[model samples]
Target: MEYTSRHTDGKRINTRSARRPCFLPGRIEGYGTKLQRDIDGKKTWNDFFFHVVAPPAMLDHGVWPDSPTGYRAANEEYCGHMMRLTRALFEHLSLGLGLEKGAMAEAFGGDELVFLQKINFYPPCPQPELTLGVAPHTDMSTLTVLVPNEVQGLQVFRDGHWYDVKHVPDALIVHIGDQIEASMNELEPN
Candidate 1:
């Protein structure tokens, strides 16, 4: 079967139309389907992307593809590893803030925490300068851990300019999300 991206209405998603809510449980999102355009109606870098969202419960239940040889085993292993790493990172960050080691974890729903992983794929663009792979925006999760490909297209806005993020082998780049930033502000409100 062809693995094509389709919308909840059974319509194929493309780069032309605006985003709509995806009601299908395990649907793959099409390019630019989950992003808003700029003031000039220009699509973000998301136009070159497609992704699958897998919730923790879904992963636990093995609701993943199994026919692609070792794909199932590899995905499960990766998910388990990422979850452990997330837990460790939370504990360290909590301790660094002078709170109890499990404070962050507890605040984030603890053992029953719902983790969502988005596996994004960005294809090659004909005119790379015209569109972005993903728009510049802060992540909405409690924390985001990104394992980027070796293409080196990731950039970070700093000091009034965007800087390329260097890729390190076997390294994961973590970002504190809006929720954590809000919590930090509450901890030390100016």
Candidate 2:
């Protein structure tokens, strides 16, 4: 999804909560830069792998406190903003496909479902080879949004060409899924 910088200085408190969706406009840029997960330059692959693996192992019969479920309630600022923006886009896409603005919104039966965000970083390899970040797959959601930080490895086959999405800042990439196709089929043909 698109993002914008929110600047806050150390004196006055900014207390206004986000009530509406925010649209970030920008095109993806650059081609071959590497995305690093080390925000403070202190994290390592060991850190990422351990956390990613440990969560599912704990999800046997009960909910985990530190997983996506916990993150949503605690990260309201990010979650709320994301909810608004996502709902808005879904509405727009619904209308574009000849449905009412809130038509798709009602179909979801309220937004109590868990939202998961995964960031995959692919650093430059010495050979840039003999490694696969993720196996080829299809997204099972209504849409999949991807933002690449640098090195390009994502590819999708369509028609006769393989489309490559290079890394770009503030780029919101959307991949439509089978459910959306079904929705489109229900709309009255114009």
Candidate 3:
């Protein structure tokens, strides 16, 4: 479920508080937000994962600590900006591949493309070495545009070993997913 950033008193809610659902009587919840728990009930990965569709609905979700007008406006604006940036990247790829200017965008569905943002929040762990914030896995999308954070926790597996991905301020990292790699292979002269 999408969560607002603030409490009713307007104090910013940290991920720790947000992760726990405070089910108060007479208040409805579990709307537009989803909670995924481990099947085995054992602690495996500790992270808050949220899926936001492009043109994000306010995390407010008609719940208390209703998102402030300013926050909602800013989020909308930010999503639009990111969408434009992604489209530009797609165009660049199209041209670099010697395809039509809008070929890549067209393949991705142009304006109808669904821009999905997977926001993961891994809180500070006391014994981080004992817990895994996220299990290693491959993304099933065509591409993943990762917005770097202050903490350094990303690792990539190559031929024989895993290498840590260094965090750089103000840099965006794009990882080509399986679908994109397959498409590129299909385009190669056989």
Candidate 4:
């Protein structure tokens, strides 16, 4: 849980708390699938058919992946771990901004913080160039952590150019969203 010097300038900070365990059971109450993306008649959305899930849909017995027998347990476990990592990352970022460890979490809604995951499954495609996985836009959440496959797809816009971020194995990409930007603006000195 230590924030590396690369993310911080020579400052090593551990954002995890002893009270927070590795796996949380009841914390994720429920899981649900928000959509089964198949808008265009091509069967999938440019090789990427997306599905979103949240707690409410799960508890209400919403559409879930029925084919994968052991998906519920696995997805639950993955979400739990990601939540923990996100909390730690938020705290570490808070420390980076010279605020209390819980400051960012508090700003992000504390205990009521919602974590909705949008999973984009990119199947094998013959014409890869003619598809759009996701349109060019900014995320609206406080933060977003992307766990992508070996495929190099993510790009960052800079200086009138789009630069593809090289894929590194076992790496999680984190992006600060608009809410974080709004929070930073709020913190800006007069």
Candidate 5:
């Protein structure tokens, strides 16, 4: 399907959840639709990635796509609102746990250090068991904001089971990584 990065975050970051009502953005009513363009315009899923995904400029960050700023700008635009809420959450996390109001902000230098957005497209497959669209990996940054194309693929490493991340329209996924967890140690305490 033709996946627009703009539409991706817009649709996925807003589902209501009983656990954390504030975790998601605001949901849009009756906006679900099928894939617009074929996953990668290939007759099948395997051919699609070989023909399209492997040759993309995004793969070769040094040569094919020389500009990193473009990626940054696109990410900021897509996740601006989520960033705001997250910042607020962090601020509260710091203070409620006995830190300064802007302590988290100051540690990162009073400005957002980095934000990255990844857009993935997975076409329908007869045997999804044979292959994976994107293999599992941990994000290198402090947090990861994800909006998967559909419901069946995404999973997270929790206590034990591979918990599926259900697509709740307009809801942003904010997962704190190891470093952020460490930073919060003094406050939350392991």
Candidate 6:
């Protein structure tokens, strides 16, 4: 997409060199070059994962027109598409569960739902066997729509094995996150 391509378009800010502060949900972090995961006080993972988070308001307010890479227009366009898709998916899911069309959307706060855009960039690793690009973990969001590039590295742990996710052109993968799993558990009978 245009948003992803803008990273190399020379007009976008170089997040690695800019050293800007990123405010995550629970913690604040400084921009860094390498990707490291502290597993019980030991640093692991030899990979490069760069990400940019855009708040919901940014979707409404366009990015600066002449500022470097023109990421604002691209990001804004992508976010709008995602928002509509997510809403439609929620509606279909609610119907599948034998509920009204807007039931799931209503539970998620309707028009006030907060949507944040996160773009992750993972570069090549020298010793691929020695480290992981992203540590194995469940997603924390209510839902996640992933659009991976041609180089496929995504995997899912299932049936006691890690299975590679085959890449499909022009396809989007939707993952049910922890929130949905928790809600399903609560709905289960004793």
What lDDT tens digits, residue by residue, belong to model 6 across residues 1-190? 1212223453333332332333346432322233456554443443222232344432323222233466666766887899899999988888888777887777766787766555555544445656555667898877899987788688999999999999999999899988777776433221
RMSD of each: 6.4, 15.0, 7.4, 15.0, 15.0, 6.6
**Better-scoring candidate (lDDT), 2 or 3:** 3
- TM-score of every candidate relative to the true structure: 0.71, 0.54, 0.67, 0.68, 0.50, 0.71
List, residue by residue over 27-85, the lDDT tens digit for candidate 5. Answer: 21112223222443322222111111121232322211223447434544545665676
- As a whole number from 0 to 100, the lDDT of residue 87 in candidate 2 is 78
Tell me the deviation in Å of residue 23 in model 1. Answer: 4.4
Worst 10 residues of 4 by lDDT: 42-51
Which residue pairs clash in candidate 4?
Answer: 31-58
Candidate 3 wrong stretches, greater than 4 Å: 1-44, 55-69, 185-190
Per-residue lDDT value at 33 in model 3: 21
Best by TM-score: 6
Show the lowest summed lDDT stretch of 10 residues, model 6: 58-67
Give the count of colliding residue pairs in each prediction: 2, 2, 3, 1, 13, 3
Error of 2 at 184 (Å): 2.8
Per-candidate Cα lDDT values, in order, are 0.63, 0.46, 0.59, 0.61, 0.47, 0.60
Please provide, for model 2 over 68-148, each residue's C-alpha lDDT reduced to its tens digit, 9 standing for 90 to 100. 445534544654566676678778976886777777656643344334444343433333344345545687666556655
* CA RMSD (A), model 6: 6.6
lDDT of predicted model 2: 0.46
Residue 175, candidate 3: alpha-carbon lDDT: 82
